[model samples]
Target chain A: MLGAMEVVSPTAPPRGARGLHRFANPGRFLRLAGRALPWVSAIGLVLVALGLVWGLFFAPADWQQGDAVRIMYVHVPAAWLASAGYMALACASAVALVWRHPLADLAAVEIAPVGAGFTAICLVTGSLWGKPMWGAFWVWDARLTSVLVLFFLYLGHIALTRAFDSPERGYRAGAILALVGVVNLPIIKFSVDWWNTLHQPASITLTGAPTMYVGMLWPLLFTALGASFIFAALVLARLSAAVMERRIRALLAARAEGT
Target chain B: MTHLAYIVPAYVSALVIPAWLAGEAWLRLRRARARLLALEGGRRR
Candidate 1:
């Protein structure tokens, strides 16, 4: 029965992973989240604190754009995660579809809105920065266009994932769509060189030296790392809540049947 | 004015959005746990 349909078999709880079994149980997950909550909150506070201080006050202004370039401290990291997040969702959705990991689809569903929010932030800030730098609030420039497409792709996934009467069916359909949209990720990345666009070439790229100075690089890097962690913490926190909601529904159903 | 005028909004949004979202998530988690505890405690009695 298990072989015919993909299922992620729960493994035996590992040694030294003691007390973590509760995370696998909804009650346990909630308890653990309460205990771990302070850590996530504290780390988030500290990371964001150090990053903003260094980014806003300590970092030197760019010779060309002066302090206006500080926007990149937020914009670039947000853009990176916007795409990176979709890729994460697509991968999780694939695993959920194929392996039938019980929590995988829930994780994907939980993350979609957050990803879309970040993508929107990236676009708005990019446009704001571009108006002065590139002379327009909007452009069909290749990079801008592709990024817009990415935003739509995120919206599409969110919609399709929740559309079906059966949550499982919605999950499967949304998973496939997410996998298909993965093709757009690379196109968004190379849009600058792939076609002439008003958006400036990448400030940081895989093949070449970053255009930013060292003083600027450190805080930006910190912000990027913190943002990624905060995203993880938020998604995990939401998933835990979702699991609890399901349990409450189950308990209520049992009571209704008993009555 | 120089680019100094733009800094306020940039820093403000950067600080506000993530902080708000994370704070909201934390609060929801807290509330859900409290509700669950009350329900579970009642169930035991």
Candidate 2:
């Protein structure tokens, strides 16, 4: 019996492999995002509509809060994601620092501004909502104070990350600062419990039943989902652009050196 | 709670702020994409 012998030389990395990193690469990220943007835009519009309609008309008004409580649909979620997003960015910064994932730092960079914007929205809206209920536009209450610190931390992350002329240096230092700042997130959560404050404590949590009824909860849920999608779409778009800009700058630098 | 003032502001903030943010993000994305496209065209020529 003649045994069939086959010799195989090394095969190239898979079709998307060399570009596996390329998919992570900005150019490819943009190509993929270009396809995704329209769908995200369409779905975002629908979700916002459903959330608003359900929140405003269909959802029952709270017995205590009446229609004033409908604001929670937006307020709670914005505040929730504001803190959640910082943690996410910090995690991304950590990954970028540790593994130096090609686009990880850029991802962190592009996202801070968006996250900062959300945090600002959260703070201002929280204040507005608080004024009617608490009788003041602002307070030094623990949770509010802690959240303000979180906002400052975000601003710091933005400033520090862009401080250095060398992008790598800026990213590494910012990553370190971001990780250090993660401690504030937990502190913000516990601040209400730890201190007697004007800010309302958590209405929803894991160990106990939620104070909000399903009618109210549903709108809040939809808004939270809508906020998440908005974040994803924005982050994708910004990251794709950042990557493209870097490529353009590199090309120009190369051309200059050649000349 | 006096409902009208709170309700109006709540709805307004909810609608206006996110709309503003969406518009801002869209504008940034559009500008960046346009610049990149212009660069691509220049390179091709």
Candidate 3:
């Protein structure tokens, strides 16, 4: 079965392995990320602006929810990014633990706080949107509860990563926590399907057509793309900072020894 | 416009949080780069 699978697979190295080898060096990553920063940031900012404007002013309001429906434009994208960011963090943690990649460790560390922020935004916006619709600001519904747990996971990862004086100790602990937290991702994704909940079922499905109309869906898609790009740019910027920090520490250590 | 209360805050929070996070990262990067340059210059002297 394995041989058959390999035969059917492309001749190229697995994309994941290829990516790991390609940017394993911090210096190489910094050079590439630095070159890409300006373009990525500019495009991200432009798309976000366009998406918000179009979503707020042009997208048709829902017949049911009226102006309140506008919240979906922001809320849905925030929720999407919160989950996506955590996935990135978990992947980075896995790489750090498995390959002992310094860049991966830093990537995981830097992503925690940003992912936490996104999760917070998602929770807050969800509450705001929920209030007008559900007649309450908070619910103990499965979906809501699982997402709350996700926010806490991000917080826990951040705290663990910074808790130890030895950075390596912190990295190992944080990576373990992140890997364990992977259980929550699927729970968050399938909560509505698995349990009774006040939260609505997903309108966008991979196997089925989106329930949203084109007008609203278009702006949502734009905002989702824009948010993703912004997330990428932020992660790259943080990664570069981390690389510089490591270099500075090494330089200081050498100077002290020499003196 | 009553719903504006909810609508405005949602959008504002979404935009502000990411913006603030990105801004913080950028500032840290700038400071780190400047410090590194200073260290390198001092070494050259």
Q: Model 2 — TM-score against the truth?
A: 0.86
Instruction: Report per-candidate DockQ.
Output: 0.37, 0.30, 0.46
* Residue-by-residue lDDT tens digits, candidate 2, A82-179: 88888889888977877677788988887787778778777777777777777787888888888898889889989998899999999998889889
**The CA-based lDDT of model 1 is what?**
0.73
**Pairs clashing within candidate 3:** none
- CA shift of A45, model 2, Å: 2.8
Instruction: List the candidate 2 regions with Cα displacement exceeding 4 Å.
Output: A1-23
DockQ of 3: 0.46
DockQ-based class of model 3:
acceptable
For each candidate, the alpha-carbon lDDT, in order, equals 0.73, 0.74, 0.84
**Model 3 misplaced stretches (Cα beyond 4 Å):** A1-19
Best candidate, DockQ: 3
For every candidate, what share of the true interface contacts is present? 0.34, 0.35, 0.68
Tens-digit per-residue lDDT, A46-89, candidate 3: 88788889989998888888888888888888899899999999
